[model samples]
Target: MSSLYGLRPLPSHGRFGYSAITRRPGYAWPNGARLAVYLGFNLEHFAFGEGLGARIGPASPEPDVLNYSWREYGNRVGAWRCLELFDQLALPTGCLLNTALYDHCPELVSAFAARGDELIGHGHTNAERQGDMPEAQELALLAGCHARIAQESGTAPRGWLSPWISESRTTPDLLAETGYDYTLNWAHDDQPLP
Candidate 1:
């Protein structure tokens, strides 16, 4: 295919080549189940005023209390409620966590860990985008997150999901070098890619 940007070639992550699903061989879920479902519960933290966040209303000046409190509500109340529901349902969950939670609410992270949920690395905070960092800084971010999660959660994460689903061109390469087995950043295919 022609390069979308003409002279400037499209950046490639080099993780996997495109393959049509119809041309691929069939695969079955465990016990021949037709489908599978699991909860990807995001437990994130953000800087109080000066970082990226999903605004409920129009953007305001520093210390966006309205949006900050809105997100904080998840950690303070919504997460506990959801935990109760998950317990009642007896469901397995994959907790995509920001390492900042260790500092913000260690108890909450522990609750999920106690329930045997898979803890996946989700950067230090959603306030910053990984794609914007220089390669060295990005590497440090990935390594720091990995080390922190492993130390706090008692197990290193095997998967990753960059905050805001943002990624630099070398993100997959960095993930592999940082010992991640998979990433949630790419969701174009129904099946996992190599």
Candidate 2:
């Protein structure tokens, strides 16, 4: 084993373009301030039917559910509840969205857009996890996710988190190629890392 272990050198010069607004130092949460609360939804509740066949099949739970009402419930009840809370607090909230939500409830998607809320894609489907697929498949899936989310959400996704916290060896490169501005999958630092 080498004495250097796994340590790698970091750039010693030049500034990384960044800033903070409505914030103070030593907080450095983002934009130089502490985040009061970050609201995120896996957004997969829509695909509960396809992902969890029980939600739709004969083996379905005794919920007497509609064809695919999970997202509708999420948007109408869950999202709205969250929005109302934020409104009461006048707080800035973030949303973690999944691609499938667009298909399930376009109006809900529009609501988020209308509010100008922060959004980041969680993935195409709640259960179509990425970390287990082959590199090529992962990349293709990532590309498809980006396109679908943009088509439905009315904006190109700037970041991605993942369904079920899943990822493959190639997730990084694939995410980069998919035109993401950043990712929150491998968080392990006091500050955000690329």
True-structure RMSD, every candidate: 2.7, 7.3
lDDT of each: 0.92, 0.67
lDDT of 1 by residue, 107-164 (tens): 9999999999999999999999999999999999999999999998779999999999
Cα-based TM-score, every candidate: 0.92, 0.68
**TM-score of predicted model 1?**
0.92
lDDT for 121 in candidate 1 is 95
Error of 1 at 76 (Å): 0.1
What pairs collide in candidate 1? none
Backbone clashes under 3 angstroms, per model: 0, 3
lDDT of 1 at 99: 96
lDDT measured at residue 36 in model 1 versus the true structure, 0 to 100? 79
What is the clash count of model 1? 0
Residue 187 local lDDT, model 2: 51
